[model samples]
Target chain A: MSGQTSAAVAAAAKSVHQDEEELHGLLVPDATDLPLFPLSAVESNFVAYFAPDFTKPSHDHYIYRHPNGLCVVGLAPGHAALRDEGGVKGVDFNVGKSDRSAIKVTGKRKKNAQHFEANTMLCKVSTSVDTYVIRCCVKGSLLEVNEKLVKQPGLLNTAADREGFIAIIMPKPADWLKVKSKFLSREEYSNLRVESL
Target chain B: MVAGSEAEEDLRAFREAVSLVPWHVAKDLISREVCLHCIIRLFGIREPAKGFTSLSPSMFSDIVAELPSTGEGLNGIELGENKDKNDDETNEERHPAPSICSVCFGILQICKVNDAEIPFEKNGVNFLANVIADAVKEEGHEFDSFCVEVSTPPAIPENDLSLLSYINSKYGSESWLQKKPLGNIISLKEALKALVTGPLETKLGVNCSQGTFRIWLTYKEASPLTSCDDKTPVAKRQKTDCNNKNTLVACTTYGLVAENEATEPCVDSGKITMTIPTDGFGNGIAYHESSCLSKSREPCSLSIECYRDAVYFGGRYLKYSRNVSQTCWMIDEERMGVTSVEEIISGCILPFCRGDKSKFHAAGREDIDVRMLGSGRPFLVEIQNARHVPSIMDIKGIEEKINESKSKLVRVKHLKLLGSEAWSLMREGEAEKQKQYAAVVWISRPLEDRDLCTLSSFKDLSIMQKTPIRVLHRRSPLEREKIIHWMKIERISGSSQYFVLHLCTQAGTYIKEFVHGDLGRTNPSIGSILGCRAEILQLDVTDVKMDLF
Candidate 1:
């Protein structure tokens, strides 16, 4: 926090939606060497964006996913009040200040339930700025969540998929042939923006 | 090139799924109709019955009224609720939906988008097609096929772009959440083609492509390109704040104005508008369906007048009058003759062809005093905006009639229609043919029989001819090499040191210059090569050996 600026100073995210940033030296990773999720994953209303380099005046940003099964969620500057450490009785998500992960793993219920369905509710992530409800985008088993983010939750805003991971899950319903049609390819994802012929 | 992209593999895998898509599986993926035969889906309000769009109007409306209260639009609908009373209630009272064909459904019962949908309009394709069809009929030309060209100002849609910028700043484009809702408006060119091509083809009863005729449609719709805040102060479309969504359209260099400006000179305040056709689009620009469909035969804001493409006729003409030139003679901006070969021929063909303008072309031309003989010279006349060429008209009769005319100045042979491509071939052969000429020579020295014998051995003799003094005022003085293929000399009575010479030479060899040497501009001429000063008193082209017809 002395030589480099991080989101620990919540003001960095206050006007993030305006494209006006007063950022400092930061890492800008490219799309290469990134984890790839199969296109068979469920479709959802949510999308993700990451700003890697704050130094260059302009640069093109592309989409990437954590190969180890972790996703980062940006937060509002005032997320300290919403910190849920432990789950309430009969509640699926942790409701208090107890250490927890953003995604979860459980036994498969059935095979047909795995097709392009939604709201699988995985885990929860509490960053320095905000709290987010993470869900399992595909039918998968949780490997583990990042232990490093427990004591230093600011890692959720800074390192994200690298040192700070939400969870690692192997996709479920072993027959990949049937579920592979759910995910979008990179070109299809890029084509979400209109292009000239 | 960089390393092979993994994104390509992703596209291939997705294409595998695309191949398995069920053609016409549902009336449409768009959920519009609902009824008794309609099976409740895993996550939905009631969808259409299998093989049917809807059971009845009452059943469809009944389900729509109950959907919002159940919070189904924001999330998924609950299934299995109707399991108990299914058979008796649905079968006894409600009527099943009718089975419809894909083609019939598309034409007669295609459901339009609901009121909640924005930026997506219905019948836009039909509106444009009908307008183009009627406008094309108004032109009253018999054409097989045509293409449509739409011109737009490439204006920025500030509101939609602003919405895009708002998404980019928060999500940062590094993840999935921001990728889906980036831009709202499609590229203008793509949208225009999608709207016009299909509708136009259906209306004209022919394919939009591979037709004998070409139709050009221009729409000057978009606002002028917005200039960046640079001081080239030359107004150029500079993409700045490109990552921000508010300037999304500006940041894209693919706008039509930017494309047209790439090769052409930008004059409209350092920007280019769309290409304005010869018949200009009326003053205001057109984009919307209502404004474009009923406006007029011409598209621009100002009313446009339309005209047909030109028709061409190729024939060989015999110019009998030595005083008549190929075209009208103009001296100091004043015409000297009432008519030329071009005018006399145009006067005869134009009345039958219904054309407005005429242009004359020939393989090679002779001097005004030289009359064309033999099979005549290959010529073509391009008749602009020709409305008709009657099938009953006799080409041979026209030729005879022209030959019998009182003037008899220019008579045509092999009068036939020719495509426009032959015009270039006729022009190209002008330099390749061999020409034979009959001339009266005047020699300064006494003519001897031995000197005339020396000229016969000069076969295939090549000479360097510069621009002659007579034409130098109008022609550039560049040197050219021409070959005298062969020359024939005939002896005539030398009463006044005059002799008749029949010479055969190359096309464009400048025969007059070769005999007199043109002040030494032409080397090895009859005067320079024979050591006898020579000049030509009269010259006539006897035979032009190229067959262009």
Candidate 2:
């Protein structure tokens, strides 16, 4: 009986050790150079398009269009709006009588959303020196605006390309094809704006 | 009645069993308006008395009269008056209301039929079986065996417990009981099934077995007697709020009054406190007496339903017409295609099985303009509540019928009846399956020898594809990487710009978008690789690789 008990004890200890080893294997992270916030991951999926000097001069904007035809709109690095002394101090979605952020675009049908032209006013951004009205760079239906910018306006100056994206737009296939030629590719945009940088 | 001698012997045994119940307990239960079936079932005599399950209330009273009453006070004046009224009724069918068993409502009594009772002389197992068999026949199902299921109201079990408590309190210290009043008692549900199953089997010419086919007999108190019912609007309720009130009363009585001997709430709860009735039994009896008096003589309503398990037919189908869709597609109440592959196949098979409805599923679907040629796609048709499960020969007939359809849009192959496991097996291969397609391509520039070599050289080319523009409104926007497993271009004899581009790819890769590039939504497409504009005119699914039929 003592011998049997000792064997049982050894088996129990072996199982516990195996379980711990399996758990440790799961807990150990894989060796990778990928960062927690990997910018390369975003760049690999969405192709960056740029529209410089839209309605007025130096009003540059970038349309990062995903392969699925969803465009993430934001200010390009060469935009005159970001050249203010104190940077962007505040952002307001109430451009007109109605607040653009209050509309809830729900379901795949995207009900209660409005269609906008390429030059439609999206929102207003205030700086220490001047206030600028941002325009929708792509002709499409407006899906959503980044509400996080209201509380943290400094994000637009620090990380405008990432978390500080202005709006997401869904373009119809015909509309996308029609407005596609006006925007320059990433390589073309960088080459054209080389002197501004 | 059909088998005279056997019915007589069964009736004789039933009377002998009734005589065995102690006279005092019988008199007390009869006074409380318990049905004879409820009394026998409460004592757990269902197993031996299974043959004659349907005894009339008058016949039961006649047997109770011969039980040799030992005292003058045991006449049971209420039961005597009910029996006299039962004999005087000209229709011979007693209205179940006044004497309906307080415990079972009227389920065991089987007395209520279309708001009128079955005549007392003919109220037996045979009569009940006729009622159930007629309903089964009306449904037009073909079955060899079935299991009968019985469901009763909550009050039935409550009444059983109440009567048992009365028995324990009144006969706790009697000389006949050497131990507590716990014995081999069958439940109300089991007793009803036993009574009905034997007769049902004889009448329907089928034996009771543990089969997929089921005959469900649901008994409910048509209208419960509750004082609070007047305040609430009547909207056709199945379980009344009065049953919930009774449960609360039973709960408070169990927790406070029967402290040491508290049982669980249902019939199983009674088993825990079988040793003691306690002081709660008195209040329980008083509550039952007042409610039983207030309850109308209306018997519980019975509804019968028949169901057979879902029958599956698995097969492969070929679509010959480009106008035919994989399934029915409607846009704003207008048809998208002439017809669908689902309609032609399901429409042919549904009437044969006589099922309630049919559902069509496939491994994957192609565009309505694309024809499915070569081996065909695997699919399954599930017929819910199928009255007739087709045999192997019947399936062959159906296959021949669908293949010979006049429209000639769809044809089926390898049509076979399959078990339910076929459903899971087809679904398992849907995600990872490979598909091959052949498209007629037209390029802006002439096709050269190097172009053919470049296309065939890549063994596995990975490309980023987004949700196609045609389906973007319905599908979530996401960029997915799919593999073009292999490709081969077949050159036309006289054409310089046109060639048949045949390629095998991952299951969900959009073929048309890969050729024209959907305005560059798909990267490194044929248009980009060839350094020219490309367009696909016609496409056909050459093969789908799944091991299922």
Candidate 3:
């Protein structure tokens, strides 16, 4: 009789543990498992605009501006760099004389943040075919460059809009207004790239 | 301020009590230039001695002369009217012979009202009451009861200790000392209050109760020598102005040697062994030398201040204009909204209370664009130093004034006067209460029947949210878990993409972020469940589930 009671206790404890697991899944789903289609989490918070063939043909990039003036710079899906075979094999933030990621930007003041022009090189991406240099595309203070792409270059190939975003830049209100009319809005970009996408 | 018959009866009681004191101690203190009221208080006489407050030094001499002297030579000292022949020579040369008291420092001798010197003969309590009543009437306060607050100089407590100790050491074994030990002596503060409270009540036409309305009488020793002496250390002068009651009582009781070193210019080290100088006893004669500097002392400078406690007006307030903020919000010297709910409400109530400044607090606040629509939100306005506390009808008039203003931005309901306790109650409800909001939402995909079923199925659904990017510049970055208690969808008559999404959520839940999901920082959001892009257009608070009025 004692052996039977011990078995019943073990079974009940297992059920309780399973219940906690099910509750955890319902409450805190992992960020990648959020079930959003087509767009990443970062894409949802910003208004996407595109800059196509700037200074060179087929050189395309996307600028995602949040309501606050911070803009995320990255390659659009139809960019010439993403068209390379085997996708991106390596990412580097050391294209310029100083490594962009090594510069420490601290505090609400964004101390040590470097000012960049619209054509400043943010980083370099190497595919199996050839390497391509990505530009900032907007004039602003460069707040941060995503360091995750340097360690996991495959993230750019898989989720470019999410974890593979390039530097975040803060443009002054006057600067944002000057460059704001130059880029295509999301609808305008979609219409232009309907055949290519 | 007291009636004539009552004053006479009080004088009779005071004289009988004075006659009972042993004659030698009275003559000794009288010759020391201690005033009459201080002598009565030093004998530990706790009677209602309202009549003796006006007695000058000579009248006090007459009272002591009637008592038979225990010693023969003391009679000469008692009969003379304050002849300070043996006092300090420098003190005598500085002023006239009729100097302030050695112990009380003219606090019990004269009252200065409205920059005019009124001696005790004019009744200090009566003049004090007149000054206080004039100020109260000038401000036009409406109070039914009041409490008196008294603050005296630190030197006065030190002097009381010195004189009481001198009497105790000189006559420790006398029959009068045995009848009422020196320990039973009333403090100068208590005696002054006893003499003043009755007259003040009569003058103000109010009863004396522990009420919010207060009359403060602050007394400072106005010795010109102390202020002008450039050689005095700044610390010592500051110690004199400290006037902290508990520290004074501690120094009086424990006989701190440090006190003598810091405070006394004429430091006598031998008196350190005295037993809680509060007991009116000292072991050595060194303590008596300090109180002997009685000549040329001026009366304390008296200042009166009247303050009514912070009056709280509490009610539920509704905001109709979306351009009005919950409070005055300023960013980099620029105003965000046209005005605030605080300005509209406090502007009306401040004139009624006549306060120095007013503070506005609410159970919770909405964004500048969100309107408070239903029963509104609980709020309180705390008015500090109010001269007038409004009646119920006055509060109603103030509420109507806010609602009927030309702006039509805010309205109030169930307006009433609340104690300070209501502030804490509203803050307590602010953290734990639930809030319901109605949002005009648009989705990228068409609204299906299953979408409504999917959104309404969440009950007690918990989600983790990082602070939204809009507020991240100021707030600490943290993930907070919030509960969405329930949600429902109401279809618009002619629109599939736009509908009203009603949701009940825990307090502090960001409703706009919960719908759009703040870039997936909030999990299981409305946009996530519908598997499409969702946006909140306009929001209104429908209800706040707190029991407060």
Candidate 4:
């Protein structure tokens, strides 16, 4: 909401000190801890990638920066998708807005079955520039996930309970958030409907 | 001054008294005393002196003149008169006797007795003295000097007591005589008689007479008197004398007796006879000549002589085995255990009839686990020592006998009666010969194709190896060169593989280790070439070529 430069915003996000104004900018209230589950632990095809420049379609994608070098990057699937035709068709059409909205509503119904929970509002956002660069500095513990997630694809179906989500190859962090928020909001809305009293 | 003059005149009278004796007599007495003094100085005798001052001058001169002078012409009349009275009587009967010796008395006699029958020619005196000296020395006496003196018949040879007493007393001090006490007086008489008779007449030679026979019976063989086939006749010449007709016969008889006494029975042909059996089996009886049935006490060196004889059995006649070992296993039952070699030869009746024994010589031995497969190991067996003799025409029979004796475990082919040189060559040629073998190796893991290819390349490669650890305890540690003549993989089974390896090596090369390679103790081993642990399961000797020079 404030007209802050990208550098200022990055600096403010990185600052360890929690000021009232910065806290208000974060979406989830009264939560400082982030919950995380490994991407591999999820059964559903919910995996995402953050591509800084969609037109160039290069694999060099950065998720976050920390004092200790680059902390997250896109894992190149490379020719893995090409070798399996079923993998492409299953996730290709779902990226459209209408299709995204419909999946969000379905995701909301499935939210109760997911396991992980998170408070942080730092999501990877896409930009209008030819190269989309998303910058968010979060606490080191906010991104940690149990290592078993890498080995089992079923574990990734759980909700990520963490302060941040990182998608290095995807553009439009806000749009991604809207889709995720809609899923969560609808799940909450549906639970209210079920409990009339 | 008057008393001094009287003392000087007394001194002059005493000097005159000492000088009245003849100068030579005084000189002789002085020289005798000087000689005694010299002896005393050399040997350090510590006897005290006695006074001779009271003797009259003539008496003193006579006593002094009695001392012997070294000169030939200076004869002392008193010394001549002192000779024992028996000497004067003998001086008339025979040619005048030499003055009697004071030490030996007249016991030592020198008489030349000629006997024509025996073929001995020697001077009597020198021989007698040598015999006496040898006898005395053998008795271990310490006498510094000795001389022989003879008395003629008029003198009672035994009665001259002074010299006899001296000899008797000296004999008492001799160590050998003291240990075994001889009848001193009787020994003196007998010794004198022996000196007169020589060794042939007396069983005890001059040694018994001179009291010098220290060691009796110096040899194991019988006495020469028992050995002689002819007996000498004795004749009584007089009441006091017996005569031997031939002194040469006497001497020769004694010499033969001495020879019999000195020669060892085992080595002496006259005492023992050895007859080695000519049967194919080296077994025979040794007998003493005296009794045909009695076994000889002497151990004899064996010399085996072989003869060929034909054998007939089972409707087929066969030549007896040739060059078999001297005796059958039954004969060697007392010596070594039954070797597989013997069992193989004796298994069949044909072989048993063809040869009594199997003589085996090998370039080297293999572990019992190994089988000699190719061309059989180069071996030679001398069969003629056994009792079964094969004729020259029975070569086919001999061949059949050897083949029939063969067992599944062992077989002898190409059997031949090799020359004596062949045995020598088998023994001596081991250092230069080479052998080939095939071994089955069990590896710890399966061999990759690359490893197999690498192993095959090892053919014809030479390797230097220290003796394998498995045989280290029995063998001396040594480095040997073994050339891989050829190697091929016969088959592969899981982790086990079979290899046929040809090694051109010295006869005794450890073939099994060459295949499995003993923990890299052998260089360029099969295990190392294949880069896996390997061990031998079974081994067979394929070929052995040994050349006889």
Candidate 5:
């Protein structure tokens, strides 16, 4: 439920960095850098839209990118599950590090290793309006994270999709092609922002 | 009068009252005190009794005090005169403290139910429990255990006119079950459960409301279904009228909830569900006003009805006739002589099994025009109330019975008893198994044998397909990938343009779409493979590779 355009974030940025270039603030909207694809099925209540980075970093690991959008993750008291390595802040993880997380494949469940439909909550995202949980829409191996965004969170506001990548997801060849097909390209997303306004 | 005979007399009087009065007027005449006593008797919670289920005594008394009441007046209700028929204004009397007893009894014998020593204020829970405990001996099932299930009459909720008022005054879009049902109506299930559990366990030699052999005690006080009710619209209710009296005793453990109109026929056969696998035995008792007030006899009519639990059996069916379908196929509610694979088999075996209803579950189904030929398609049939079988059934005899269909519509083999686990295996096999089909293909031009040589090389090749047009209305339009394992030309015996193809495909491959190409909705179809147009004239399941026994 939490959502805002780069322009809106820039306006809100009027308070954060008044002296910074206003044109740069509005022109590079990181929040808009989300990956989403609609499934080719009836929109039964069962269907979920996935919007996160999914790039293969190397031969073995995949990446799940955060939308160039910065979500205010809660680090409230008594909540110990979401501890950042350095107590960095909010939902952001360790900065300046890009590493592939190893995944274990066992049991008969690995047959559909490329697909993810069963859901699990990874973290909570709080926007100015509301809070929404960032969930794994389907099941698959999560291979890597773009630690670069943690150190340079501005990439989300500036270069959202390409440089503002979040984490990597490992899906088989067929599923990868399908997930990639649903994402809106840079030009299309720009047009969408203009039309939405 | 003997106490046992008196309870029977009270039952006779109750039946008389039901026959004599309209249920709505009767609804007013039967007081909460009577309901409280009757519920206690039926559940047998206050005292342990043979044949009857029991709950704790104290809880029963506590619940009675909290039961929604017309509040205090017990003398106002008059059944025979029907004097208070101020129809429109009477609706406002949502809570009528029915103090008068016109029926549910014939002659007051002053039985233990009306003992002077038992305080009327505390209710006759203790005394009445003792009397019911003596009136009958316990019935037994050969099964190891027993359980209790309560089914309240639909008419119980009909009395809750105040519920609408409460909703309008309260918040929007909240479910009533979240709060009190229909305003202060104590749950019959809870009341019965609290009253019967402990007492029943000590007496029945089996756990009450705990095990698999469940006995459904349905208390139906709704007005009898008329010829008109058949055409009338009912939202969600499984209406079965085996006996005129509303009470039924069923031994079915099937989940009983009537679905809405939008529901898909739960079985693949696509027929509306009307009954469970077994029929419930119904016993009805009526009461007269004076017979009800008489304490010697409890008002109940006992026409003993017995029901047996459903049994499971399975077999592989071969549909030789292409004119038949796996299930009934009709358009605009009209049917031809075409019998479905389910109908032929259910018709043959249901008679021997003597079940009220039979459900059909198969590995998969073929189109109405297609035929199932090879070893046959595996299926599981659950016959409700199959009394004869748990005693060594003759599988070959059943196979012969199924093959006796006049039209030779279908044939069944490997008929055997199946367990619950087979249902899931049938489902899994349908979704994930490989299938081989023989199709009669007609091409636009004569095709040489060499032209189809590329078919032998295809293996685990994936192709994209969109939902075909014929099924577009039923299925969503979506792009899905299916695999084609291999294709072979089994025979080129037909005309120059006609031939046969033996194809092995993934579980969900659209063979017709693959052959005809559905205007390129299916890529690399037989049409695409050969540089010519191809369509299937007839198709048959050569084999379904589900080795599940």
Candidate 6:
């Protein structure tokens, strides 16, 4: 093979290997499912927000998901890219700054930055069709905006891929305000939205 | 008329045939006086013309004063004046009063006629009465056949010795023989004969037949006899003053008084009265009402008098140290040196002492040699006839006196004053009573521990024992059963063992021989059990118990 074609093939093989490895990880039960909260999350001001009309409180809910339905969500620190109407860089996301790009998660999630880094993966993500994993991050006032979902990126577009892709993806919310209120504080519900696709 | 005269003649013939004897003799023989009088009154009457022909001479005299005056009188009547003067002088000289005889007819006459001597003074009337009563018994005479008579002595002048001399000259002498004339004088002879054969034969310090007699003539003025008139009527006599009289009759004049009062200030006043031993030695005068004497037929005056004599003679110092054996030892002519238990009590100085016989009881007996220690064995010594009875202070003295008097072969201890009932228990029971014993034995060889073990097994075992040969002379040959209560042994010197064997057995068991086995007479004995020949070294009695009052 030529060098460029060999490099592309080698990268694709590495990515497939990584996916296969993550798929194995998703099949096993996680420590969080066994009722073990991480010591770092308990120390920080990591609050789980509930929707305003949620039947049960947020702490009672044992399962959490990413907006892309790619991974189970757990406490992590990260920055989310904020864009104006036209997809443009607005501000750098940090833990304490209050800017348009800075998102404030209310309730117990607001204080998570002191003890935990902004972007960290706490649990594995598994699904019926495809397995995706996500890590949460902390912005100044926003939490879901900074999350990253990793999915099986490229494969031949087969029937199994489409079905697996739909099975693994988190359903998108009809009302972003309600979703935000469910993930963050009610006071910040108007300013932010949470979507899982 | 001729027939009537003929009938009278026949009656005279029949009267003379019936009247024969003198009136006095006939009166004395027959008891019925009226029958004699009726015979005389009917036969002595004569018809008026034939008076002399019909009556007998004695009968005719008796009825002569009763006949009516007859026309034909006798011509031999003496002149009245001359007869009257002679009768008057004779009447003045002789007092012709008739008195009943003092002597009863049933009693054999002991006095002679015209014998002035009294019957009692020569031989005590009451004493002779007893003797005569005994003699009558010996002769087999019935009790009512003889009557007793007490004769009164003729009055004797106090100052006139001449009257006594005159009487002595007239009579023979004042003797028992002279007083009773009915039989031969045999009292002295009989008394002497009895003295040889009687209880006096064993009495010491007394001659069998020794009595003194003396004869003297003296005049004695007698008291006048009291008169009892037939016609005067019978009345109870009042107490009379006899103080002025020279002589007073005891029973009659004194009229039954107490002896002390009767003989007050007499010679017997100062002496104590001796009482008789009725229930044996230490027993006092058994009262008439006493149950012991209740069965006696007659009142026991002899017992009473004997008690009086014993009390009177014993005086103040009574010795009660000796055992009260009922009988005394007798040897040949004397009662030996041993005095009777009664005599010992009687001779005791104390007037009122009492005691029972001495009994020897031992817890275990010794062979006459071993002495008892530990308060000299618990024994009871019953003191008898204790005059001057020891007070608490005198008990020690009395005990010392007894110990001093006896030989060391026998020792008396635990001296006590016991009642009469205690004596009865000792005398009445069997001698073979249970006793405990301790004996020291000398073995032919020393005993081993095995032998001692064998001896210990003999405890609580019963053994049969034959009489010991040494005491066979006094005891019957018989087998006796004795129980061994317990035993303990101690080793003494070589070949000698001191064995204290306690046995509850009949009282008279020979403890010494029992230990040694009496040459095998006592089977299963200490010697036999140990399988060794043993001999008694010493035996001692440690305790004696008798249930007594």
lDDT of 2 at B233: 16
Candidate 5's TM-score: 0.42
lDDT of each residue in A134-166, candidate 3, tens digit only? 899999888778776889888688757644677
- In terms of docking quality, how is candidate 4 classified? incorrect
Name model 1 segments beyond 4 Å from true: A1-197, B1-140, B156-207, B221-311, B336-338, B346-356, B389-404, B444-452, B491-499, B528-533
* DockQ of the candidate models in sequence: 0.00, 0.05, 0.05, 0.00, 0.01, 0.00
All candidates' chain B TM-scores are: 0.57, 0.81, 0.83, 0.38, 0.54, 0.36
Give the candidates in order of TM-score, highest first: 3, 2, 1, 5, 4, 6
Q: lDDT (CA) for every model shown?
A: 0.45, 0.73, 0.71, 0.34, 0.45, 0.30
- TM-scores for all predictions: 0.44, 0.67, 0.72, 0.30, 0.42, 0.29
lDDT for residue B384 in candidate 5, whole number 0-100: 67
Here the TM-score of candidate 3's chain B is: 0.83
Residues B1-549 of candidate 1: C-alpha lDDT, one tens digit per residue: 112233233223322222222211111211322111221120111211111111222333233333433321312433222221223245224534222211111112212212111111123245445656776677665655665543323232331232222223323233332233332333333344544565567778877664335454433321223442222211111343232443333433322112222333222221112221111221111112122122221111211123445667888887766688888888769775556888788777776666667888887788776666655788888877555553425556666777788987777878887777878878788778888776666676667777668887778889998665455433444568999877766655323345556678888888878887654557778877767567766566766777677
Q: Model 3's CAPRI class?
A: incorrect
Better by TM-score, candidate 6 or 4? 4
Candidate 2 off by > 4 Å: A1-168, A171-197, B2-23, B48-50, B53-57, B68-98, B161-185, B226-287, B292-295
Show the colliding residue pairs in model 2: B97-B297
| Native contacts recovered, each model | 0.00, 0.09, 0.03, 0.00, 0.00, 0.00
* Per-prediction CA RMSD (Å): 43.0, 15.2, 12.4, 41.8, 28.1, 56.8
Relative to the real complex, the DockQ score for model 2 comes to 0.05
Q: By summed lDDT, which 10 consecutive residues of candidate 5 chain B come out lowest?
A: B268-277
lDDT of 4 at B374: 44
Best of the candidates, lDDT:
2
Task: Name the lDDT value of residue B303 in candidate 3.
Answer: 68
